[model samples]
Target: MDFEKIQNEIGGFSRYQVVVITTVAWLAFSAGFGTQSAVFISAIPKYRCAVPPIDDPDVYPSLGESDIKNYTIPYDTATAEYDSCNRYDYNLSSCQGDGDLSCVTFDEDPGTIPCDQGYHYDQTYYKETTRTQWDLVCER
Candidate 1:
């Protein structure tokens, strides 16, 4: 057979091939976009421990939002950010005041566990996320 003749006859990629490839690529991209959009729309934002009630007389009496944030939430020293789930072992009932907070050396404390109280969503980026509808923020 003549290699040069076959090469000339075959030429480059055909118009039909280009169109089919383009169509397939567009469909794949669209499917991926749709899947990702659904996931994002259903995604729950990061959450921390909720602010303690001011009127509660028993638990952390006279405690405010600042005091709760300063004491309850566990800190990530490497990232300089607070952990989304884990909180200090000091339960709200046990915490007498701000001074009772265990903020430093979280690793040293073996009693660290998941947040017992409700979660506070970080709404800085999103106004609302699936977390509002579904309570899927804590534990695996």
Candidate 2:
């Protein structure tokens, strides 16, 4: 119960030593927790869509030239030449050529055509299986 006796028994450490020990302890704690935090943050987005903001034009580029002209000519009975072509497909060639083409279909899966011209689709396919697993974990 004597405070002075307890203090004497504990002995004294140098101020520099105390400071170094405290700093080392803090660094070790941060290293452990910091790594864990980083991993968890990275894993969260991988398990979900979490779509990022579209700011740059280069982020979602244009489609092929021949594909655009053939598909977007405005015909009553339109036929898709490419196997990947569909009604909702966006003509990426025009966008790249003039940078003024604003036509895009929300429903269609983006398609890519191979040509010398700058025409390509920005397709993003996300599997639902991984998301389902995350959902199960969240439920638990």
Candidate 3:
């Protein structure tokens, strides 16, 4: 009922008010960071199609990481990067005994296909992330 009396009793903009406001502001700032921290933890790392190792050495020799990318992965000219979701559908028999992967022939138009095996995440930056753990990079 007595607005002026209450205002004087509370003390307008006193040191106590400053301390309370500052504490609440600091807590709000910290809470904001806490809520947004998932962006860093759940970040998507560099990844690619996981090309399974050749089980039968006679069919296709076990290739190194780079060799696998060169032989199986398709280079996207538009993005100027290796395609992450798809790989070139090739004939395993054709690649047999071919030390030169470049020389290996492919289907008339060996179009890119979705990865059948899985995905390979580059763990250099993030050891494990949601995108890598849940395989959320590409469509199911």
Candidate 4:
């Protein structure tokens, strides 16, 4: 009935037993990683609202990427980063006539909307995670 006593009567713990136990244990450990690997491979990376590209260069002067992001994305004080789900409801009509790119403006007081456009993701760590592949990070 005692497992240890029976094992000892048979041959105790031999090198063959050690090798077999270790091999089975190693296989189980490696299989665990294989099953759970999706957690890391499909992880959601840092992301933000996608910036709308300039439709007409003549109508609206070209703005740098940083400038566009600064104008469109709202700062989230809670997260201390630009908001991922919402962006400033900007009006590009002001930029229609004037050559100044700064003419574009949006309401800061009561003007935040869910990202109607697609999202931009930080792929520095992962080139394409689940968040980027299926657009899972954006709020509907």
For all candidates, the clash counts are 0, 4, 0, 0
lDDT of 2 by residue, 1-81 (tens): 887787667775568768999999999998999777743443322221111111123543453434444443222345633
Q: Point out where model 2 deviates above 4 Å.
A: 1-12, 43-133, 136-140
Quote the positional error of residue 71 for candidate 4 in Å.
0.4
Q: What is the Å distance of residue 92 in model 4 from its true position? A: 5.5
Better of 1 and 3 by TM-score: 3
- lDDT head-to-head 1 vs 3, winner: 3
* Cα misplacement distance, residue 105 of candidate 1 (Å): 14
Q: Model 3 over residues 56-125: C-alpha lDDT tens digits?
A: 3453565656766777889989988988899877654344353545434554668778888788877789
Angstrom error of the Cα, residue 43, model 1: value is 5.3
Model 2 residue 113 distance off true place after TM-score fit, in angstroms: 36
Candidates 1 and 4: which is better by TM-score?
Answer: 4
All candidates in order of TM-score, best leading: 3, 4, 1, 2
Better of 3 and 4 by lDDT: 3
Model 2 vs. true fold: TM: 0.25
Candidate 4 residues 12-126, lDDT tens each?
A: 8899999999999999999999998886568788777764443334544655546656777788788878877887766544544334555445433638888776777777798
lDDT of 1 by residue, 23-132 (tens): 99999998998887875468576677663442143645656545555566767899987877777665455444434444233456546677666677767677776665
Cα lDDT, all candidates: 0.63, 0.40, 0.72, 0.69
- In candidate 1, stretches whose alpha carbon ends up further than 4 angstroms from where it belongs are 1-44, 54-67, 94-110, 124-127, 138-140
Cα lDDT of candidate 2 equals 0.40
